[model samples]
Target: MTLLSLSGVSFAYAAGKTVLHGIDLAVRDGGNLGIVGESGSGKTTLLKLLLGLERASAGTVSFRGAPLDARDRGFMLGFRRSVQAVFQDPYSSLDPRQRVSDIVAEPLRSLKIGTDIAEAVAQALRDVDLPPDAAGRYPHEFSGGQRQRIAIARAIVARPALIVADEVVSALDLTTRTRIIDLMRALSTRTTFVVVSHDIALVALLCERLVVLEKGRIVEEGATREILARPSHPYTQRLLASTPRMPARG
Candidate 1:
């Protein structure tokens, strides 16, 4: 089932300054999708549209086959509960002052899930490989990778059907980044993942499908391995060439 879709979506900062153009995309259930693009390739704009932060200028952004209605409180509430996000900056994404348990339980409180909140938060922490005691500590006490794990824990605490991650590993060191990626790879089986990043190699490791965006337009898209093995678009080829070693299916 397609959980989210954008049909002929176009966006512009102003009348003439368009960022995205005539894009058609769908995020299916239980699959990982990567939206690959360089800086200023309208990646952030598209992310905003996907997250309902911005509406498309010329097309429809649909959730479960219906056009998005942000004004409809009931629909939005359900949408928020079903879909969650983990953002780019781990340091800033988490509130330094909030305890880890409180941070992870934000979705549960907001979504009003009636289950045992403490148990849910604890399970989320365990899912990310963080110890039980980690919950009492603050975000400042953990390393960058651990903080990102907390962020992931928070995102999955609600058991949302889909998780949208925007450059989640970009802020971590090399060793930390690999660990986070491994965590994400493990979690990908638990829920749908939509990973947006400029790093094609990272996407290759995590996403089974790929959508290459250039100048606000989709230039190439296919199975991740097929695209990496033989890229048809110049922009995609450039992206692979620029990557130190594009990840390939073995």
Candidate 2:
């Protein structure tokens, strides 16, 4: 079943400069997809369109066969409730003033989800491998990896069907990156993931399929393993050649 789809979608800024052009993509329910491209490749713009932060200039963006119309409050609310996001820069994404429990419970509270907010927060923390006591602390108290875990905890606390992750591990060091990737991998078994990253190696570990974008267009797309092994596009081949291989796990 298709959870989200973009058909001939296009976007342009007020200056009339196009950022994305006639893009077509679909993400199935429980699918794991990666969008990869260098800077100025419309990767982030595509995400913005998916999130409804920006409207498509032409064509359609749909969720579960219905058009994404922000004016329709019911549809907008349902879409927001079903989809969650995790971004890069754990330090900045979280509020230093808010306790971890409150941070994780924000969505539940704002969305008026469960009646037992405390239980939801605790379970979320546990799911991310953090101790129960850790919820009382502020974001500054945790290390970078731990903070990202908290972010992940908050994202999944609502049991969202889809999670959009944008450069989620780019700020961390090698060891921390690996641990976070492993956490996401474990979560992907139950959640659909749309990962956007310039790090091909990291995306390869988390996604089964990939969409390679260039200058506002999809240049290549296929199974992750196939593209990695036999890239047909020059741009994709360049990406593969430039990405440093991750060291083998012991």
Candidate 3:
């Protein structure tokens, strides 16, 4: 089933400054999709549209076969519950003042899920390979990778159906990046993922299908391996050539 879709979607910041144009895309339930582009490619803008942070100037955005309706409280609430996001820069994404438990439980509190919030938080931490006691600490107490793990914990606490991750590992070191990617890969078994990144190789690791954008429009969309092997667009070829190759695992 199609969980999220954009048809003929176009967006503009102002009367003249259009950011995205005629974009059509969709993700099936439990699908893993990657949106890849460099800065100014409208990747983030497209993400904003998908998240309902911005509305399209020209097309339709739909979730579960229904058009996105911000005015409909019921639809908005259900959409919020079904879709969750993990952003780039875990250090900044997490609150420094809030305890880890509170950070992870915020979604549950806001969504009013009715389950035991404490148990959900604890399970989220454990799922991310963090110890139970880590919940009592602040975001600053952990390493970069651990902090990202905490952020992941927060994202998964609600058992969201779709996860939109934007540049999630761009700020981490190689070792930490690999570990986080592996963690996300494992999580994909139970969740649909929309991974947005400038790093094509990293996206290749997590997403089976990829959509390459340039100048605010999709330049190529296909299977990850096919695109990697035979890029049809000049921009895609450049993107692939410029991205550093991932190191071989032992």
Candidate 4:
């Protein structure tokens, strides 16, 4: 079953420059998928379409088989609760003024998903392997890895069905990156993820399926293992060659 999908979608900026071509994609329910591409490959624009932040210029972006309608309060409320996102820079993604507790609880307050926001915040902190005391601290108090974990905790605090992670670990160091990847791997058992990254290797660690985007169109897509072993497209081959291969999931 598909939770969110883009059918023949396209997008262009006001300058009349097309960023994405006719594109078709689906995010299967409870499954992890990766959208991989070089910079300016339309990957970020596609993520915006999936998140319903930007409307498609040509085709449909659907949630659960119905067109995504931002004006429909009933539909949008549900969509907001069902899909959540974690962006690239943990340092900038978080509010410097908000305490960790309030930061994590923002979704609960905005979406009104749970009654006990405090307990939910604490539980989310636990899920991310942070100490309970960490919640009372500000964003400046933690290391980069810890800050990213806080961001992840906030994303999962609502127990949303799907998470769209966009270049989530790109800003972290190598040692920190591995630990966060491991944390996400553990979290994947209970939540579906759509990971967007320039690194084939990072997405290979998280996504069961892979979609390659180049110049605003899909160049190739298939099971991650199959694509890793035998890439059929020149663009995809280059992506694989550019990144060190991470150990595949068993």
Greater-lDDT candidate between 1 and 2: 1
Off by over 4 Å in 2: 246-250
RMSD of candidate 1 to true structure, Å:
1.1
**lDDT by residue (tens digit), candidate 4, 1-250:** 8999988899999999999998988999767999999999999999999898999999999999999998999999999898999999999999999999999999999987757888999999999999999989999999999999999999999998899999999999999999999999899898889999999999988989999999999999989999999999999999888888875684
Query: What TM-score do all the candidates reach, one by one?
Result: 0.97, 0.97, 0.97, 0.98
Point out the worst 10-residue segment of candidate 1 by lDDT. Answer: 241-250
* TM-score for predicted model 1 compared with the true structure: 0.97
Name the regions of candidate 3 deviating beyond 4 angstroms: 246-250
Question: Which residue pairs show collisions in model 4?
Answer: none
Error in Å for residue 79 of model 4:
0.6
In order, candidate lDDTs are 0.93, 0.91, 0.91, 0.93
In candidate 3 the C-alpha lDDT for residue 6 amounts to 100
Enumerate residue pairs that collide in model 1: none
lDDT of 1: 0.93
Scored against the true structure, residue 141 in model 3 reaches a CA lDDT of 93
lDDT per residue as tens, model 2, 1-250: 9988999999999999999989999998876999999999999999999888989999999999999999998888889888899999999999999999999999998877866889988988988899999989999999999999999999999988899999999999999998999999899889999999998888889888899999999999988888888889999999989998643221
